[model samples]
Target: MSTAMAPEPVDNGGDARTRRSIARAVLANPTMVTFGALAVIILAFSALAPGLFTQGSNFVQLAQNVAILTVVSVGTTFVIITAGVDLSIPSGIVLGQVFAVQALKLLPLGEGTTAFDATANQTTALSVLVAVTAALLGGLIIGLINGVVVAYLRVPPLLATLGTLGAGLGVALILQDGVNSATYALDPVGNGALIAGIPNLIPIALVVVIAGFVLLHLSVFGRHTYAIGSNPEAARRVGINVERHLLKVYVLGGVASGLAGFLSLSYFSTTSIGGFSTANLQAITAVALGGTSLFGGVGSIIGTLIGVWIPAVLKNGFIITGVQPYWQDVAVGFVLIAAVWFDQLRRRSRDRG
Candidate 1:
């Protein structure tokens, strides 16, 4: 109205500065952004569903839902850090579960022959040892095969893991006659609570998180892992023994899957042979969404933990909010793709600068 034309439209470059600031902040601590997203989801879901999503019991349930996943993802986080994939994680987990159950049969548990007929009272220390050992060995074997094929035989990581995925599951099926077995040998570990009666799974997961954090973030082994993923040739020239280190990495991943299998059996009191078919994809998605580059050399235990929770919250929230179940997959897919794209973009920017 005053015909001043807003002083010819001031252009102070504040928008550019703000964007640059955000980019710098994100570049410095990418995990923070993912955590922020998780926080937002929690808040949004809590708001949308009110008391349902914010209940203490629901959170405990949420923790239980993700505990096994958190355990399994520890080694997976390392694998991705080395720029490798372990598609056989689910099979490895199932094998562990199967091994634990079969080992239980060798004990005097007196099962009544039903799929879930075993009781918690039948659990014994010897039975526990057998189950744990069997599960760990089963998972470790799968990991070893993957490591050998990928490291020495020059098979691509994807193909090697894919082969093991089917093979491991097949072995499990053969051992169990394609049926999930039951034993409460791990019931104490699975359902027992410590410190204020928290579910045992959460504490077990917390321990794994601590161990994984130490292994991946604070040790030379972790450094070697990042170096290998960042530049294998350079890592090799530096005497990193890329092949052996990779083998160890795959082994570690297998061990983690095996541990997850044991924990899963403990929690469910049965082998969930058909329950975790998509678990590998879920682990990959969590790792990717937590800012680990698919191309490798970037990730963290904390990030993976948060990544595990995002979808868990979404599914739980969606149910509470009456959203269609399929939308959860659609939402998670979009988030994962966006994360990977942003990761690629960040990588390009780093290379350029």
Candidate 2:
């Protein structure tokens, strides 16, 4: 009789333990949700807007729309991984465009007469190099200021970058006299495709994403970045140069933003001085949505690449499905909030695990 009574096992925490294990795994690698979410979103949109969203040309157009964003987001991935933010992305982009245009203006040219003339609506090897270099250098300068202020002067990254954003935009506006510049020379970089159906921008973005993956996931530099972000004091104790590393991270972010601007100009064949106003926010959203913690210490460039498509898909899908375009922003806002909330849940899982 006693044996029969003992047959009923005592209540245990086995289920709870299983849950904690899963939560911990999710915490360790958070993008599972984003991957699932991306799939669900795509399926739902395809079902809801079959003809427009499912067409071949629309997919190509969508890729083109997000190409520059992919480049910007990869850089943002690095900064956010270190528990830092860069609000000056728009500034870097605009300034890069302005600098590229200025570089073009400085080049000697024949109007519509030579194959390699800026004035002839064509770009030469030298002009392309000068333009790209000037744009990249412009970004580096902005990044330097951001790094110095945050790392050395000890300003908060958010505040430091915000200040840089305002100041840099002012400088760009002043330089361009509030007007956008135009050029037909760099169109190939934007529109040309080595593959018959693929745009050049897609491959450029692919290269950057691959390079970023190597930098942030495989290299020693990434480990240090995670260490600093996870625990700066601990990182310092372990002999990491936190300040210098932060500076480098910010510089990389700046350069990426500048490159985005250059790409934007190439694609559009002009600069929108007032364009990209929300680019920094959009980029940060893509980074965060990709499961890179705003609180820092974890990230994936591949995840970010997936994240970049969410806003784009939502915008295109909503419009195609007869939903109001403004709902795009609302949908993205909710998704972002959910992402951050999930991040908090992940932290809790870590604590429990």
Provide the overall lDDT of each model, using Cα atoms, as 2-decimal numbers: 0.87, 0.87
Q: How many clashes show up in model 2?
A: 1
How do the residues 1-353 of candidate 1 rate in per-residue lDDT, one tens digit apiece?
76465666544779998788777887666588789889999999989988888999999999998999998888899999988999999999999999887767766534445222356765566777778898999899999999999889989999999999999999999998878766666787788785675898998899999999999999999999999999999999988899999999999999889999999989888898888898898899998888887788898888899999999999999998999867889899998888788788877777853
Q: How does candidate 2 score on lDDT?
A: 0.87
lDDT score, candidate 2, position 144: 91
What is the lDDT, from 0 to 100, of the residue 238 in candidate 1? Answer: 81
